[model samples]
Target: MVSKHTLLSNDLFGDLNPKDWPISLADLPPGSALVGGSVRDGLLNKLSQKPDLDFVIPIEAIKFSKNLSKRINATFIKLDKKRDIARLVINGWTLDFARQVGKNLEDDLLRRDFRINAIALKLSKKPEIFDPIGGMDDLKNKKIVAISEKNLIDDPLRILRGFRLMCELDFELEKKTQIFLKNNVDKLSNVAPERIKMEILKIAHSNWNSSVWPTYLELQLLKKWNEDKLPNLELKRKDIFSTKPIAGVFLAKLICLLSDEGLSSLKFSKNEIKRCKNLRFWVRKINNLGLDNFSEDERFQLHVDLEEDLPSLILFLNDKYANVWLKRWEDPSDPLFHPSSPLSGHSLQKALEIRSGPFLGELMRHLSKEKAYRRFFTNHEALEVARKWTLENSPFL
Candidate 1:
């Protein structure tokens, strides 16, 4: 089998000098020889006949191929094509590109959004590191610096991306970058809620949950949203610099803290609002229970109640007391607080031998409640009780 890297080299560089192709392009998959075209042919002739030719020239292809090159060592082979493009595939990365375009890797690196991501490695011609944006310095300093100011302005989503990086990379925002973020926090409002929600979820799921609230506050981004109705939401810049807290727990707490504000300002979808509301409810429930009265069953129930709201629950309950409950609740071996209903409407319908209707639904609910409260050992026992109750109470039965 041809080595994946060798194939990629042939695909990207072919007979061309390795120095000319961008370092990032070294990883693309090999392209098939285009028997018809010449290197001197115009871009239209090369591209018009083969759409893949254009794709090979794009930065996306280089990035994609480079990632592929890392996985497999493919051989590079020269092709006698009219255009300076070649094709090869290695571990799923393939592209056809002009050798000349490959040489100017610096221009390609500059197009990236952040300095950190702009760093690239050349695989061929005495492999070397390329950093057109000084990303290495930023990385060393633990900084989340943008590639260009305009990069953030052109796409407001970068603001959230920056926040995400801060959380993921454990990097601090540069002072100037922070000021720029504060000035443009409003631009986030223009971004789609789905995009914003994705970033928020990522942060909430990360170890940087605590950082998120404070960072948003510093930018006054949280205040700009109609979260004024949430209690204890005082925005203090110092909060961001505080010790990092558990991500999930902080998220739940944040939602509860912002419950009154309604998720509308954040542009959360209906489903997202429901999830947030459930999270808030769980947080409030946990808070109300306090540390003293929490029982194994209660803790289990807390987990069940939270359901998908688990992340939020974790966020809200960060106190020492809450931590105790979390330890118990997080134990998968422990029985769930409230197991799913043992009795269903169908059970009621079958037990009653009655047509499916509201009556069966009502009976099922009553039976479920009894089973929950009484802690029936089995579904059969619950059904027996439901039968007796139905026989005595149902006019139709």
Candidate 2:
């Protein structure tokens, strides 16, 4: 009987020479079989451990498979005593193979989604690029084309994934694919909202935000999804790449645009809607401040008021004013941009000897605003004011 260690070592060193070992085999888990045999001998044994195993390659070893172990930092070990079976971990995913039907790497590339992602760079002897589906040509053309028409139908989420690819790679959707997308926009509703939100956020953060909306409009996806809810969201060509085109604003404008179409549909959660609403309110506030006459205190207050919304606010303000406002805020002499607040609820409680309750919380909030505005300098002053307000309003005090 062949020992498990001998079988594993032979498979591990089978295709790969000792000189080309990318990772030390000693790092692998002890007592673990690198590759296992197929069902004919004992398929149930393999299936029982399927959860721990990664991928299984058939008999035809594709070109991409040659260096798969090196690329993924896996140890290629064989399991079947009767055949040349092997298994390896690639990028933490277990890749296995039965000595039955292994095709070359070109076959694997052909099975992927877009042509752009199908191109793989080899790392072994006579290293050459392998593009099975004109992926390099598509990349050169700056186009996003699917590997096959059936790929999209098999997974409708690919429609949104295509949109995300446009944002990430700054590529254009092929006209035929665009048409198909428009025709099948309703299929997106079948996908989960969380997934849709993820893709939309990716687009909103991309440099192609402005271009993305028009595509959304042209494809009638906005209408189908009932995204028109915000007001006066005119998507000019310039807005696509604007720095202020964040996810919140994009969603707000899309909702507003959809609302205008008499649809009033929203794809975000309640918290997300609230965040967008807050962003819109603050963006308007910052915009109306008019950078020319913006005071240091006002800018500082704006920063404090916006808090987490500051970056997006600045982006929005900059987009509207064309860096005029951002430049103004960047000036060292600008007073509106203040330092961080020195007060906190805990500090207030300790300083005032107050218990954990709404009274102290309210007092702290009032003091924070006063401190932010530079109305009070010392804790004593803040406490005095809080005492006066508490005494005037409450008999308990």
Model 1, TM vs. native: 0.59
C-alpha RMSD (angstroms) for model 1: 11.9
Candidate 1 Cα misplacement greater than 4 A, ranges: 1-112, 192-194, 222-270, 282-305, 318-324, 327-336, 378-381, 388-397
**lDDT of candidate 1 vs native?**
0.53
- Residue range 305-380, candidate 1, lDDT tens digits: 5644453454343455444545554564333433355766665666668768777766665554565466566778
Q: What is the lDDT of residue 128 in candidate 1?
A: 38
Candidate 2 lDDT over residue span 176-223, tens digit each: 888767777768778766666666666655555456667766876545
Clashes per prediction? 40, 36
lDDT (CA) for every model shown? 0.53, 0.52
Best by lDDT: 1
